[model samples]
Target: MHFLTHNTAPCDSTFSPLYSVVFGCILALGLPLNAVSLWTLLRHHSLKSPSAVFMVNLAVSDLLLVVSLPMRVYYYATGTWPLGNLVCNLITMLFHNNIRSSAFFITFISVDRLLAVVYPLRSRHLRTSSNAWKAAALVWLLVLVINIPESMHFSKFLKELNGSSCFPKTPHRSPLHYIQPVLMFSMLAVNMVCTALVSWTLSRRLNDSARVNNKVNVMLIFFLNLVMFIICFLPLSVGILSTNIHVRPLICLASVNCCLDPLLYYFCLDAFWKKKEDVDLPGEQQLKDIRSPCVGLE
Candidate 1:
């Protein structure tokens, strides 16, 4: 979304209003959705499952982005950045961090499910809750390490633009110029490979009516990740490599991933809920015994 706003070529003013609306909508939807998701993961589900661990990390990443939206909304709405360069850099860092972190966590979840279906016995040790949490920690640590250059140089870019508004601009041949596209495309590739594996495994298991519901639920996970990759990740990744594209809107569009991710939670947990429902409660079992009037118990 960065363009050289020199006197020869003034920045487009129209994008400010559009950005305002987009950020506003993202804040409205993303905030509540992520909050509830975090609560559900922490309160209802123990983070002992690999899926739950990945989801909780995803929710935490989304909340980090969600918290930064207010400043973005203000910047766009007022068409200014009264906030200092430090605040601006922090906001930019959070934005990029969430995008990368979310991508990794989503890919991890896809692979986790794929392994669960494809190599249930072998993957059992690999997919433990402890391993999942360790993976999550590694993702955060790696994201911070990778993004340090961006954090250090972000304010400089804003200062160079010499505008009242502060937005991330990609300068050709810069460090970020190389890093973002590479990272995004890598995540996209991993997601595609994982999705293909999940699909193949599910297809092979499709004939088993006993596991039909479970397979369908897992397939939905692939479908959603594909959708997220297409709509959010693809454009941004490709656009970063091309000078002709204005990437600002696409970056904002990526925020939709936060809201959409909760849908994955629903699908992933479908099997869990089904199993819960299928199990008879102790009280129900007692009532059945009373109704049957077992001779010895009577």
Candidate 2:
């Protein structure tokens, strides 16, 4: 999806193998991680917390990208899109939508943590599970609205290619292309602010062991969110701004975030990796002891 002038030349042979290998790895890792994340969120009733709700939505977004990778892997490996135009458009849209939705959800998680850590009592009313669900709904709606035109633009196959090319470099730049960099940067800024505030809050609690530990956990959540933005979304945003940079490899790098997202789930949800028995143990005291830093259940 690098913006290039419409030309008949086939995609760079060198990058095709790279895409196949990278996308294959993403599919292999992302599938099980997100699957288990989703399962844990539902099976344990983790959705009681707003952060858990966002985590569930994030896992779903990652799975959307994971399931679409097989076809992308096939196309890159064989240099053809046997799936045809409709599927091509769909895959393209899914890729973009996943990227945008993932960014938004990750930011939501960070903001959830910020509220939980910095303004716990005050934000309690705003951080309800219902509000989280509403926020997730808005993210999906915004992603769909942004990608609709891109899907229409992507509907046509590149006829000049030797065979079907699902995402050949197109010379024409859609207005949406310009919007992506701005969106990525804005999300990055939000994550950074959340991370900073969480870190500062942690510093204030160093003398109290339990509160410090809890604040550290909150810091870790925001830190990972910032890292995801920098590593996954930064290059693609930069690539979108500069035509001289190759965007295909950046896109592949961006896809790596799908695998990395499970880390957020593990850290954001205290019950994500805990045994079912442990999570189900009786008593509100036990639950409070293990409450996620993002939940501010205390």
Candidate 3:
């Protein structure tokens, strides 16, 4: 328990209030958003497609992370960890696992879109719902394998006069920490490639107004995914390697992604935002008919 004796006053003073408020906001917004996203995805039979499968998994990851925020909110608001070490470890692991898993699922969504747009005919066999599920399972397995050790390594409780802290700054380093940034960058690279290819493919079809519009919409989704990837995960990746940067803010920033992910669900699944009546009426069915060219490709 010698590691617990180290002074963590600076971290507590800087992060406690900030984390409390930030995490509270995330919980309030993210919980409902992700819950609705999951409900919408599952309700509409959207899981039939590979992209929808990835979206469903992504929503699940966000929900898992969001559900754990209340514990974090209490800890940061009160600056104490009365939940015990086991719960603290679980929470830490959930945070790490979900963030990276969200990235992986987002990358998968981009790649799915890329294949649908850029290599629709050739990549047909690769873009099945079964493959998506298998890929999602692999992502979870890989993330758990990578993060379990790292979470355990860094989740040292800090003893305070009042109580113990769940997550305190530790001077120790782990190889998994280094690997995290590499994995994030590699996923980022994949998103970039997908975005570029999709854009080029769309550019060639600009002569067809309707087709080009649909492809542009598809391209925008990938662009948003790339932007979100850079905004949410890039800072943490950079902070991992740099000594001067505080990771608390980066983590908080990343938490916002849980709220933003529902937007992807809205755009990717046409039925997500549609009302029951709107979906059923023949007059209003034109909305569904304007499907993306990449719709059935996945």
Candidate 4:
């Protein structure tokens, strides 16, 4: 596993220009879009819907992740982690939290959709925003608690050794390595299960045109989530599989997620998608009314 050869070393970027560009794009674009999305989801929309509440939190988590990427940019440009040890722990926690929380929120959204379609009558009570926020709150608390070890156990530069090369300086804390794998597997597992449910419900709903809009939204969101899941965790998974064996960073492709996530936000700006329109009508007047700055979707 990568943990053994990892040697708690700092990674010097031979790919600085590449990663710098990528991280910069994410920082410049993802942060603002995610923040606006969060604001729209919170103040502008009625959080009484479980789905909306979760979406709001999802935006918040994504924003947190976006905000943290700048540090990565700085590291890439400087080729050293000048931020000190405490920042290392915070950055690790923030990155993992954003990824895990996003996965769970997507899974929750998929399941909520499935129930609304598969069991409409039962959904009224179960899908209330109050309950949705409660469930999302519980997930947030659990994710925070679970990642505490990664945050606290995190070790940075021993200073005396590998001063420039930063890594998981887990001093006598080998248990920390397990944290990444555990979180990765847990997220992938949950996403798989929830995605299956989303597929099943969407299949049934496909027969009815009235449901197609929501279906499209869910499908797009699901696909977006699946992509994010793969990108965010696959490298970590590969590193774990090869036992972190590869000489180079396993997943350089993950850099695309920054642009991709923002595209999802632009997708949200679509009137049909945001309002969950039953019909895809082409009326500038109607679309404009719904598309106008977020105002608690009815």
How much RMSD separates candidate 3 from the native structure?
Answer: 5.8
Query: Can you write out model 2's per-residue Cα lDDT over 1-298, one digit (the tens) per residue?
Result: 4323122234444237678998899999999998987897777765657777888898999999999999988877766566667777777778888889999998888898787666765675787878989999999999888777776665543344434466654233566878877888999898888878867765664446666676677677767777778878877766766656667777788899899998876664545644343222233343334344554322
**Could you tell me which 10 consecutive residues in candidate 3 have the lowest summed lDDT?**
275-284
Superposed model 2: Cα runs more than 4 Å off: 1-15, 156-163, 169-172, 206-208, 211-219, 274-292, 296-298
Clashes of each: 0, 2, 0, 8
Q: What local lDDT does model 2 show for residue 213?
A: 73
Clashing residue pairs in candidate 2 (N, C-alpha, C atoms within 3 angstroms): 4-171, 5-171
Ranking by lDDT: 2, 3, 1, 4
Provide the TM-score for each candidate, comma-separated. 0.80, 0.83, 0.82, 0.71
Candidate 3 lDDT by residue in tens digits, 1-298: 4335333543544337678998999999999999887887677664667877888899999999998999888877765577776777788778878878999998888888777666665676787888999999999989878876676565543223233556654323567777777888899899888878867766664457765676667666776777677888877766767766657777888888898888776664555544232221122232334355334322
lDDT, candidate 1, 1-298, per-residue tens: 3344422233534237678888899999999988987887676655556777888899999999999999888776655567777787788778778888888998887777656655655665787778988999999998888677767666566677665556744422246656666766777788778767655655554445534654565557667887887888767766767766667877887888888888877654533232221211133242232111000101
Backbone clashes in model 4, listed as residue pairs: 1-243, 2-243, 2-244, 10-165, 10-166, 48-129, 50-129, 239-244
On TM-score, the candidate that comes out on top is: 2
lDDT of 1: 0.68
How accurate locally is residue 262 in candidate 1, as Cα lDDT from 0 to 100? 82
What is the full ranking by TM-score, best candidate first? Answer: 2, 3, 1, 4
State each model's CA lDDT, in order: 0.68, 0.72, 0.72, 0.57
Give the higher-TM-score candidate: 1 or 2: 2
